[model samples]
Target: MFSSKTLAEMDRNIAKYPPEQKQSAVMACLIAAQEEHGWVSPAIIAEVAGILDMPTIAVEEVATFYNMYETKPIGQFKLVICTNLPCQLSHGEEAADYLKKKLGINFNETTSCGTFTLKEGECMGVCGDSPVLLVNNHRMCSFMSHDKIDALLDELKSQAKKGVSA
Candidate 1:
């Protein structure tokens, strides 16, 4: 169910391990599948398991264990706010509350417009940059203040209107 490019990528990842250890590429394959499909559905999980020659449960374990992998469909912009101790010590709670009020959605919830998904996250390895967030699980936004969050939301809304992803 993956594109040829993704299959090729999986092949390359699989080649990294010895012949009998194809399962070593399970995470890579799952990531490729997610990149293609936007989320890891049961079908994608099964396809990954088939490609890795591993049990479906094994793939499921990896998918479920990792917070980075989206198990369900998410909005175009997934805003992950760090809520760990360091972040809490900062204005993380205020930022999250601001987001919730601004977007009218709680953590782990997607906005009604399907433009954003808010998630509570653990430490993103940047404790000093408290009140930090990750966009689409890739772009790191640090030291978010209220005004900065508003600017970001406006920018993302503009991007969404233009049918572009950030």
Candidate 2:
């Protein structure tokens, strides 16, 4: 269910590299597929392999290795809570607990309203701002407070309900 624009973008990405190097475009193609469907299906991965003249296993490797690739349905917004050492030291698990308590959904689960999905991620490279959480892949730079998380969760719900961002 990929759109023409996305296919064209993938083709352009392929053109940017030599024909023999289509493997280099694997990441872009997978991302394009992900953007269209929110998750990468096995069928699409096989199609990508055929498009790139590579093996399906090669495509799967790329998809599984990358943190950005999602294999399951995520909500309209994905709240990835970083729980690595730096984040934990800075109250990362606390934020995750807050989300679970507030949204009534644990890690790797979507909220009952389908407005948000909570994912447990590793260090998001914001050690300086250690307890960071990502919303729909957008880096939210501050953390350290449960109220901020409550506001974020509330805003996401409001946005989903209205079909507009809050």
Candidate 3:
């Protein structure tokens, strides 16, 4: 279900490990699969397991255990907010509230337009950068204030209009 380029990348991940320990590349393979499919499904999980010679359940377990992996379909943008203690103490709650109100979607929900998916994330190891969030699990957005949030939303919307990513 992935392009040749993606398949080659997965092979590279497998090569990083010993031949007998090909399963070691499961996590990286799952990430690549998710990047291609946008979410992990039963079929994709099975494919990854087959490639790595692992049990399907084992691959599914890794995907489910990590918040970064989306098991269900998500919008064009996945907004993950860090609500850990330090972040909560530093305006994270306020930022989350604003995002919910603005997107009209609660945690673990996606907007009607399928433009954004809101998720609550664990600590991202940047306490000093409280009110932090991640876009698509790759872009770390720190110091998220109301105005910054608004700007981000606007920027994302504009990108969506152009069929691009921010």
Error of 1 at 137 (Å): 1.0
lDDT (Cα, tens digit) per residue for candidate 3, span 10-58: 9999999999999999999999998888888889999999999999999
Clashes of 3: 0
Model 2 collision count: 0
lDDT of 2 at 77: 88
- Indicate whether candidate 2 or candidate 3 has the larger lDDT: 3
Tell how far residue 85 is off in model 1, in angstroms: 0.8
| Candidate 2 per-residue lDDT over residues 43-113, each given as its tens digit | 98998898899999999999999889887777888888888898888888888788888888888899776
TM-score of each: 0.97, 0.91, 0.97
Model 3, runs deviating above 4 Å: none
Total clashes in model 1, counting residue pairs 3 or more apart in sequence or in different chains: 0
lDDT of 1: 0.93
Task: Give the Cα lDDT of each candidate.
Answer: 0.93, 0.83, 0.93
Cα lDDT tens digits for candidate 1, 1-166? 7889999999999999998999999998988888888899998999999988899999999999999899999999999999998999999999999999999999999999999999999889999998998998779999999999999999999999999887
Task: List runs of model 2 lying over 4 Å from the truth.
Answer: 164-166
